[model samples]
Target: MATITVFGATGYAGGHITDEALRRGHEVIAVNRSGSAAAREGVTPVAGSIGDDALVRDLAARSDVLVVAVHGSADGQPYLAALVPNLLKAAAEGGARIGVVGGAGSLKVREGGPRLIDTAGFPEAARTESASHAKVLDALRAADTGADWFYVSPAAEFGAWVPGERTGTYRLGDNVLVTDEHGKSFISGADYAIAFVDEIDEPAHHRARFTVAY
Candidate 1:
């Protein structure tokens, strides 16, 4: 029954997380530029920018967990790279753990293997965002704040184009990529939401990165 604050509540991952959390009877603060109402009921909406350190600190201080699914690379903003430091500051001030939504580009296919983004077949449309997200993860790993934070990377076949059904099952992985017998990795949005909230309740993989896939 933790109070969770989602920084990009209108987006795909954040919206799904908000839905799953509310379904589980947790308090949700959905933050977005518009502060728009969540499509579902039982959500408290907050309209603001993550760059506001004071506001973010106040929110983080009040909540038990802060879910960061905000990224602006595609729109040419790169806000996540700039927001990580302030988020670290806010989390440190408020004692809230951060649950970061990560990109698959950072996941290693094998020990000492090249990252997915560095691989030849990566999409050009994803290259900028992937690099930006990688930078955010790097900052989170190197930050001196000592705040509890963890990154959650999705699978290779994740995204709207790959909409999958709720299998009610998923596999968790470390920094390495998780794949099926056919080497295909995927997870539905609803299932990913379940996995994300599960971490908030269980608090496993603290201060580290863990991923999910089918």
Candidate 2:
């Protein structure tokens, strides 16, 4: 079984990934903000912040895979772009593969058209965070972390509002917004976790970014 370390184990996507990893019988080190955090069964919860370089390196040293599903502080700071590079450095030091939960803002709606974030109805409040996520992807793509780094962007319609059921089916895409038959782009948290853990089991699309949607 793989030793997976999840940095945002208490967050929405990270929580799902932690549970999914445990369900598959993998050892999970769930990192959160509080030491008293109760993650889930079979998960070893470690309270810490992503800003600590030593803490991140130590965790990555003992993990085969490191998943970064964290955002910034509660005050809405954009630290993802900053933390990712540090995570990449730690992963390289520990020789562990890194996977980051990216955003659909960097993904194109058409073959060569503008990104989804540039399209209509994109929330103004979310613009900064969305741009930060895209910047993280850009940093990852340019980093020389060898063969153990990847970024995964969810569909455009994925969020806390759309808590759909798990159908155990999804399709992967490359920097493109994935939509269904009716042009709806969405994926359930459970299903997205399924895809994330599946990638952990089978190392495909390395040193790159991919998307998952129904």
Candidate 3:
């Protein structure tokens, strides 16, 4: 099993991913701001600040994969601008791959159409965060690094509010959003974790971005 180090491991997406990785027999280093993330077998919870490039590089040096599940915006500021570069540098230096938990807003609503965040009627409050994440994806695509990386954008209805069951089934998509026959796009946290961990277990979409949905 791979040794996975997950930042923001106490948050919604990160928490599920950490548990799923452990369930799959992988060693997990769960990093959080508080350093008090709940204990679990096969997990070593540590407190860390994402802004610390040294800490990030140290962790990357020890991990087979570095998973970033934190938000793009922090305290009303775009955090990924600086953080992404640091991660790229660390991955390049430490011989570790990178996996980012991105938002659905980056995915196009339809092929050849505008992104969901750019679509009319999209929530204004979420625009900034979505834009930040979109920029991260852009940066990842443009970067030249030795380490492999992948970005995962969840479905439109994803999050804690609609935490669906771990059905162990989901669809994967490219730059476009994925939706069911009924025109609903969604995936539960557990199922999303399944996809995330699956990617770690078997690499796919290397140096690219993919989306998950029901």
Candidate 4:
């Protein structure tokens, strides 16, 4: 099993990813700004900010997969802009693959039109951070490092999703949003975890962004 390190292990998405990674028998090193919570049996909690280059590099050096799940605003701060690049550099130095938890705001709505964040009904508060997420995606695309990277965007209906039964079934999409026959886009947190773990097991859609939906 691959040794995986999740950068934002305390957050909702990151926590779910950590749980799923452990369930699949992968060694997980969970990193949070304030360190990790009570020790889990198989997960190692690493304490440090994503801006700590030395710590990040050390963690990356020890892992096979570096999962970037950090949440921050586009406030013109160094942390916001430097997070992805720092992780990429560390991953390259460590010879590991990178997996980014991307934002749905950047996902294409039409073939060549604006993204969902540009459309009406998008929350103003979320737009600020969503833009940061977009920048992370752009940076990953432009990165010339030979290290493999994958961007995974959750359905537009993400956040506070109730856990559904893990039927081990979900649809995957590329760039475009994934909606069900009812014309609704949603995926339970549990199912999203399943998809992320599956991707970890079988490396598909490398160096590209993909989404999951029920």
Candidate 5:
């Protein structure tokens, strides 16, 4: 199994992803602020920040894949600006692929239509964060050819607030949002991890962004 290093391992999405990786017999390096991720087999908890270039490079070098499940900010400061560059360099140095947990804001409301973030009635509170994530996607696209990466944007109704049960099924899409027959887009955290880990197991959509939903 691939050795995966996951940042933000204590967080919702990362936690589930880490667990799933362990479930599949993949070794995990769980990085978090406190390094207090639940004690579990196959997990090596690391207390570190994504801002630490040395630590990131070290971990990236040691693993087959680096998973970024963090946000745009760290310690109240903008982090993505440096994160992408650091990851690119580390991935190149370590020959490891990068997997990012991206935001849905960059996904189009429909084919050839405006992005969801630009649509009317989008949550003002999430505007800044969403826009930042969109930038992350752009940064990856513009990264050097040697940098191998893939981004996964969850459905609009994703997050800890709705901890829906895993149904062992999900819909996948390209840069467009995936919605159900009633126009609702959603995916439980567990199912999202399944999709993420499945990609880690079998490479697909290299250097591209994909979305997951019900």
Candidate 6:
């Protein structure tokens, strides 16, 4: 089993990823700002901010895969820009595979055109958070580190999605969105976790970004 480290262990997406990692029999280390109590048999909780370079580096050095599921605040906090690069650096030094829980706003809507966030009918309240995500993507793309990293963007309607039965079935897509036969783009959190852990086990798409939807 792979040694995995989840950066934002208390968040919704991160928590689900942690559970899925544990269920897959992988050893998981959950890193949170304060601390996390959602303990499992094989899950270890590490308390520290992403800004603490020493602590993050120590955790990264011990893991094989690092899952970044951190979300910046809507009030224009510079945490995303600051933390991700540092984590990426540590992961590179540790020779670890990086998996990012990316935002849907970074996904493209057209070929070499604007993203989904810029398109019409997008909610105004989400623009700031989306922009922050875009910035994080830019930083990751421009990074020169030599680590295998995959950024996974969930469906447009992803938030507080309850888990369905563990069918282990989901569709993957590239930069563009993925939709079902019913013209819907959504995946349950459980299915998302399945995809995430599957990628962790067998990395088919290396150094690229992908999405998941039912």
Candidate with maximal TM-score: 3
Residue 181, candidate 5: C-alpha displacement in angstroms: 0.5
lDDT of 5 by residue, 66-132 (tens): 9999997545445685579888998989899999999999999999999999999999888878888
Clashing pairs in 6: none
| Candidate 1, pairs of clashing residues | none
Put down candidate 2 lDDT per residue, 1-214, tens digits, no spaces: 9999898888889988888898999999988889554756677889898788999999889999999897632366667776777888888889899988888888999798899889998888778778888878887887776538878899887767887888899999998888999999999888999999999999898888999998
C-alpha RMSD (angstroms) for model 4: 1.9
Q: Which candidate's lDDT is highest?
A: 3
**Number of clashing pairs per prediction, in order:** 0, 0, 0, 0, 0, 0
Candidate 5's error at 151, in angstroms? Answer: 0.2
Instruction: Please list the residue runs of candidate 3 whose C-alpha ends up more than 4 Å from where it truly belongs after superposition.
Output: none
Query: In model 1, where do residues sit more than 4 Å from their true spots?
Result: 39-41, 72-74
Q: Which candidate would rank higher by TM-score, 2 or 5?
A: 5
The lDDT for every candidate, in the order shown, is 0.87, 0.85, 0.91, 0.82, 0.90, 0.82
Between candidates 3 and 5, the one scoring higher on TM-score is 3
Model 5 superposed RMSD (Cα): 1.2
Badly placed stretches (over 4 Å) of model 4 are 74-79, 161-165
Give the Cα-based TM-score of candidate 5 against the true structure.
Answer: 0.97
Candidate 2 Cα errors over 4 Å, as ranges = 39-41, 72-77
Ranking by TM-score: 3, 5, 1, 2, 4, 6
**TM, every model:** 0.95, 0.94, 0.98, 0.92, 0.97, 0.92
Question: On residues 18-55, what C-alpha lDDT tens digit does candidate 3 reach at each position?
Answer: 98998999999999988877877898988988778889
Lowest-scoring 10 consecutive residues by lDDT in candidate 3?
76-85
Total clashing pairs in model 1: 0
Reference-based TM-score, model 2: 0.94
**Once superposed on the true structure, which residue ranges of model 6 sit more than 4 Å away at CA?**
110-113, 161-165
